[model samples]
Target: MIALTLRQRNIIEYLLSRDSYVTNDVIASNFEVSNRTVRKDLEVISAYLKEQGISLVRKPGKGVWIEDKQEVLFDDLSCSYSKNERIVIYVTSLLLNDVNTFMTLASNCGVSKQTVINDLNTIEKFLDGYHLSLIKNQGVGTSLEGDETDIRRLFIDLLFTNDHSKIVYELCINNDGIQRNLDVSFELITVIENEFRFRYVDRDRISIVLSFLLNRLGLMKTKNSTIQSSDMERINSILSTKISDSNDQEYISSFLLGERVEGSLTLDSKVEDEANEISEHLISSLKKIHYFDSEDMKDIIRSLTVHVRAAIYRCRNNIHIRNELDEQVRFAIGVMYEFTKKELNVYETKYNLNFDQSEISYIALYLASIFETGVQEDLKVVIMIVCTFGLATSSILKSRMYQIFGDCFIVGPYSIEEAEKYLESHEVDLIISTNYMSVKSTNVIYINPLLKQNDIEMIRNTLFQESFMKMCSLFFNKNKVVEHDYHCLGEYISKNDVSISKGKISWEDAIRKAAAPLVAKGDIENKYVNTMIQAVNEFGTYMVITPKVAYVHAGKDDGVNKNCVSLLLLENEIPFGSFNTKPVIAIVVLGICDKEESQLLNIANILDIPENIELLKNSKNIESILSLHD
Candidate 1:
């Protein structure tokens, strides 16, 4: 019997049902997949049908179809087991059969012995991640041997990756098993969450960790769990199944600490140093390539630093997130991603992180986030006015200089020697002097010692164009001043996000509804909303930023797949916190990813004014919200 993937089987069934040919576009559209994927599926289906003496016919412009196929039906043809499923069979069989060989394993999986060998070769690579090796005993068939901690983490991760694999693994534990305390794991997690005041990202993974821990407890003697005594007391209370003797307790604690984003475990202080060094290097390297020297780079660096810390922690623990932007980021910004990956090579060995493809995707995206927000402002001219004149004359000259050179810097009346010393150290754009200073610089403007109008005109004529380029050197450093929409912070809010209340709803519900549009649009992940509520729970109603409006958000790390903002208007008031007298009638949920919180102050501007709040309530239009910007 030929094995087919789920998609391959689906394609065969679709073709068999259709009397006429289905075009690639039609198949792609119907399946909600790309045309390229449809083509690949057809190729697989064609090979399978060829073995069974049937043809899958296709024309480039026309379509694809299976002609006169009566022997094959969906029910008769079984979907092939996935690789993870095959792994479950292999590992579970090894655990069950005392003297199982490749031929025996092949018989169990219903695949060729040669196929089993190939699968083992691939599975070996995966076990390498856990530092576990597939060892073939001289007499016994095969077994996994490595550190007990790695073994526990490996089983937990396998269960997390595929639920189907769990049933097979459970068979090894059913007899003389800890099935009586299966629910104890659930209770433990709940206790830990409430006791610790943090939510684990993958509850399912944690449950599997606890279950595996129970199955392996007392099977062998191991080292201490390495978990703190204080934290382990809570675990011991939940699972008094002699868990004290087991090291699985610490792995569970470690898993809990690693999975949660907000209450992340305190890593070595060097982690922060490494993240900062990497961020600075990326910034420096990017500047060299003309990627950006823009003002947004500062925000980019800060957010990237935060992400790098989390990525390093995840990498060290062998936790991996499948970055959605992995393919697109690599495709669009391959050069930048390559540069970032190269810069990170220095830390890989020290941290034991290869900078996996997904982590690199996010890092590259942050580097790409460095962009020009607006036109670069003119350069500021830092002027050092050299004055050999008296104090009263210097004060007059300073005041006069300020009045005349409105946009340029005015540094004093240094003695000729003082001016020369200052010129060597500081980056002065222009130098104004009343006396002939023995300066070798070209920007020195010699002026009359006495107060004269021509001196002012000469200053203007000599550096008028340069003075126009001057901005406040203290605050705006020429290219540092990013052009902002000073009048309105309305760029992010639009009609797609604005929603009127169907009726009055709970503040929590209102936030979910406000953010639901973004969730549905994939602008944010489903976890983003839960994190928002968690934020409000952890902190108070500081989310309620204004009188009748509330702006709520969690850090971008909590599950913001993209950056977005949404607004919900309520006809009735809902109290966000202790502000009963001033109940919030509007809610705004901000979803951000690997970026700065750039939208809050602007959204708050809308809520700050009474008229704008009224506009949001009365019109309930996106344009109304957009117009409320300062």
Candidate 2:
């Protein structure tokens, strides 16, 4: 026997696998080695093959191939498995099969016998993670040396971690004995689903898994191993009735915990509590990317809570499943996905666990659906959305409603009849109905059943007016009213309540100077100016309403005596921060007496228009500026 190097054996096996001649480039790519290295390896391989009565045939301008006068030298290493796939095969074999010798495993995987030896080294490292070790005997075979339970757990863990897309091709591709076993396994799954009154999300994947397990039922290894699960006893009994082997039963029962049958998971108090806390955290984290607070959002909160509970159960049990939407979520909302991943580290650490990206990806997906709606607003408008369409369509409309509206509290995607009955008992601020309301209220808006783009446009405009009127109604009450030096945005300025600066000033100074007019007139105390400065320090240029203008204010108790507005018009727009891309041409300081909540909305409305903002920037005097708004 020639002492062949591992690469020589691999090159020989590679050539043996190919039916026709292969170029050095092809071999190089397969082995991830250079063509020069491959040529050298082939020289070594050729010597070894000659000793074995095999010839390494090289045809110029064609490629190199093995010429064997005899029959098949190797069982075709063409169907080579990737490292990950090989790892899965090793894990599966280690659990049930005893024929785990280097040569035997290599022959099965279509690689050099030495490749299996190298793979075993890697496999041993993986086993260490599960607190299991490989007991290998030289020139013989390897066996899993650990608790039966740990062995089973290692199997389950590896199965979920890898998709193993090709793991069951032989078993599933119409072989007689294996196909019969597959039929039994599939029937077992149906029985399990029926027994639990729930179905597997991916039934085909489960069938593949069960089929793999059934085919590997090696002539009764022993009844030594038991899978640790809350339903282990029940699973054993269930599998026992169908499967005869007590030890092999765990193979079927272990994956029983992987049953994620949507909304079917029952949460105990402790899990429920953790779920609640984590759900709130998830929402708070996502709110950074978008404004939230609605009935649909509440449903999201509940759905999120339930999902986290299931995910926690799955993680604690070391059961990870493939979420199909995982990649889609990570790509669609990459920012939210990354942010959620970072935010979830707190929960992971607090709980003393690591979460699979599949689990985190699911959370990201739920949040992405909400974030995708792109409805940015702070004021919450209560709306009763009545849809005559079916439940599925209404459910869709509700999602669409969230996508389009800001901070709205949706009452119901009720039928017209449901809305009428509800309206009698409960007072909603606005009624948005697909079917016209027979009750006929001033707040109601009718629309098409489809809820088209034009309907959204009309609905948004109506909602804006409704929100403004509702805000304006706040200051109409007498007790809510405060005696003020200036009654409105124009009046404060009409009576010596503004600043005009040439060139530029510090934003802090701009805010202070802007509020000076109101401060001097006693509409607000000097303390209000300091609060505005501190707020800007804390919240940045959030007050900068429309890129060109800023609205600065503190709480009314921050020494606001009167509801008033003041503006600092800077000739050269000054950037608020070192990195502030939007410069402030004007800073509108609002000093509100609690009743002037509508002022923010009003100023936003005026400055929101580019023409009005441009006019305000050019206004030289109080009268000219006041006239700009008018």
Candidate 3:
């Protein structure tokens, strides 16, 4: 035979198995390799086949096929046995079947007469253990004789001496065939005859024959086997007269034949009593191990009942095996039932206590603590500006503070005494007192009643400086921005119109018209401008335009607190020279700020561009900006 690589051989074998030809593309796709590699492997196989007298032909654009052959040459190479060894076994078996003429037998097996004689000598050695003799006459064929029973028994023992005997015994017991004590190694003839008769008989007759044989033969001896004490008890209980008396034989036979057994009240009562006892014990043990709800417990009990009933039926019907073996089977069933019962108990207990009230309370507190630690430290300065009356100045201060600091939880407008009382028990991290009232201690930072843009800027810088960033890094890295800050900004843009409009106005005029009111109120200027510039540099380039309502004055009683701040992006930078306000082509400023204000201030800080504002107003493309919410 020509030598071939494993891959080439595999390819050849695959082609042989197919009835029709396969394309090279189909084979390449199936193997997930390049077509070139597959073709190279196939070429090797084709050359090897030709050398071995087999022709492999391929038709262009069609496929490959093997040429016709009178005999399968691969089969000769496939067999592991030598040609002489194969002939020896074939000749010997033929002779044993009563072929007398040596020349004819030799001719039939395709071997010379001398080879047949050589094989006969080897056969003589093969039959040594069987103690049988082969006699040959000059005119007649060879005959096998001498203790045929012993010879058959020797063959049977050889075939069944290992694992097959145990498998056959199990098969017989499970199928409700004749139950016999499988302990003895009887003569092969006896076993074969009995098996033949058993196969042809009815269920009752088979059962009777099995019972008689087991009783007559006695128990088989098992050595060094681990048989537990409880196993013995279970076997006794199953084979006891109360459960399997002779009077119940008919019903037992019916049950074994896969038919429902009825008729005997005594038998029915006994089986039911045993099943109920087992079911009750399983339920009680399961309950102790775990807490199962009523419905779940009931389902488990139903399953246990089915298992017990099946076990009882098997014990009653299986009479071919000895009482000891039957008890062992029942004991195994009992152990399995006990194991299931314990597991169900544990499951019930664990599931019932999953989310008790105390657990929920702990979870809520843990979540609150997580939120406290995760909020950006720079945004944590919660200032409440206290004034005599709840009016314009307080609102203006609030808006200005928000524009400077990204977030601040401001609580304000309380009287001096009211502020002191509220701060006594409430959490006030920082207090901004606008009025010159005598405050309690040094922890409070008092600013002038008329606040300036630089003052607010200094406060923001001091609050969220280097020390605060370090503190924030302890809980979370700088790469992870807070979701709530962005959420607040997006939500505010969604509810307001922050669009810019084209006009005959200079950028400085727009900035003054928008920012001048807040600036005059001691709220805007360099800090707000710098903060807006920083925001615009970080985000993309944008254009800004003046709003039509930019000139509207805001007051406490005007019922129109025009603290409107909008965001817009433009395609190009409109020509504006550097006069702080010139680069900022559009302007949006709040007249007054209050606690109930929306997110316009944050959006303005995020997108600080005059051209962008103009584009946004003209295009009304708020959806793209607002998509940050998702």
Candidate 4:
């Protein structure tokens, strides 16, 4: 007698289960084994069948099939085996002779007896292996020790490895008589089955799968087929009844209308019709909502529609729902409704929102914070004009400083004692003192506050310019002014107006007489043009007023012109005008009169102020002088 290996027996069983033929590739792919292994098994099965006088035929790509069967030698092995050997042999024998039971045996061999019993309990796989009777005799325990080969073969013939294929075949037979039945495509059926399979194990996966298949088919056919609105209403009425019968009103409400129903109703034909009508309406509504431009909203609608539809289908199919499932559905619906409301509100306010003052203030504060954090880096300085008393002179001096510095410096007035007390702790760069008050320990640079414009300009230019010769000259010049109260001749022209001499006078004498009062006040001194040149060289430019330039302007002009003298001197000129004719006067006031300083030379040139003559010489009275100044 020839013995068949377990794999060879599997190949034979595999071929026996097929009505037509079995392919080697199919066997290999199914078993996840090499093709050579499958072929070797097939060769062994073919040789074993041949020895038994059974013919096995191969038809190349078509596959191998059993051609003929003959009576085999070991058809009755009972005579050669005892009962105990038979039981052990029967189990092992069943394992070697069949594919399904072989799988069970291989699975249970290494596990505990409890596991084997569990395997035995699965009726389908347990009875699949051999031609034997399963007898359970209470105290005797379960046994599969009786002979029944033909019955087993018949049973095996009815089964297939792929369960889905078996289901499709059964469905085709059951629904054959129904007219206009749904045409099920393989891919569509598989997709619907897989989509809800794991998610809904307790419910009928096959029924839900079929419903989706029918729905897909209907939707495809209805794509271009238009039904009138009235017909749609009738169709919806029919569907709503079906929908109602399938699910409770409250459960159905969360899905179709995004609201809850208050009461329950009987699941009669009328309720079925109402349910169907509602479902139809829901499907239409979902279709319309699915095409919404926003993807998020579309997903929301689709999810709710699917939930409601599934509930109705399950209800119609007599499926039960757990409390947990119902609660989850309710929670999902509530969340979606809230989200939809928020989205709608957002859309409503998009075109109407307005920014207010608080918003602007917040923005300004944010920008200020950024600046304070090193976004902008520049120092802003302020100068305080302090007199013993805060009176007109203090105000006048502050105004003068502001006129020169303008936005470049912050200026204010305070009393001397107030300034001294404040300066004790406050920061200041420079202090101009009009009185004899002392600052014994402060670091501030001090100067005479009663000084002329030339002295102020000299101090300013010296502080700014770094040239050695200019610094030495500035020091010597400052000392001379401090020691002798020496002021530039340009100050004489600035103070005195153009006057007609009462007696005959030479040009030099007339100049001296015009300049006499300022000289008496210790304001006018020699080398005035040199002082103005130093101011111009240090500060880039300076103003000038000659006896001639001033006199001529004083005589010819009134109002603002009387107080304003001629301004002269180019950027490169050095001592360009005489003391008696020093056209250039005070340095272009630093930081102050920026705009006026920018146009001062241009305006002076336009007014015909000259460099070599007293332009204000013809002024007759102080009124004319004040008028010219104004």
TM-score of 4: 0.17
Model 1 poorest 10 in a row by lDDT:
471-480
Give model 3's clash tally.
21
TM-score of each: 0.41, 0.40, 0.20, 0.17
Alpha carbon lDDT of residue 619, candidate 2? 77
Pairwise lDDT winner, candidates 2 and 3: 2
Q: Model 3: residues >4 Å from true position, as ranges?
A: 1-17, 20-53, 56-96, 153-630
Higher-ranked by TM-score: 3 or 4: 3
Rank the candidate models, highest TM-score first.
1, 2, 3, 4
Model 4 regions lying over 4 Å from their true place: 1-23, 26-37, 55-630
Q: 101-195, model 2: which lDDT tens digit per residue?
A: 77766765667878887887788887887888888888778777876557655554554544563463432344354455667777877777776
Name the candidate that leads on lDDT.
2
Error of 2 at 461 (Å): 33
Q: Model 1 over residues 143-211: C-alpha lDDT tens digits?
A: 777776667655654544434544564543452333555577777777777766656665754565566
lDDT of 3 by residue, 1-630 (tens): 555543555567667766766656455535533455678767877777777678777875446766654433554432122344433334334322444566765654455778667777666665655676667777786665555333433333322232223322333343322333322212221342243232221333234333333332222221111222332333333333323443223322322321111221122334345555554554454334333453634543444454343334433432111121221111112122223333333333532312211112222232223323334453365666676636677677666666765566667756789888887777654566666666543124455455653355335433532223223222222212322344433555423444444555543344444454455445444355443333232211122212211111122222324444443332323433221111333344443333234333234333333343444445545465554331
TM-score of 2: 0.40
Q: What lDDT score goes with residue 489 in model 3?
A: 39
CA error at residue 446 for candidate 3, angstroms:
74
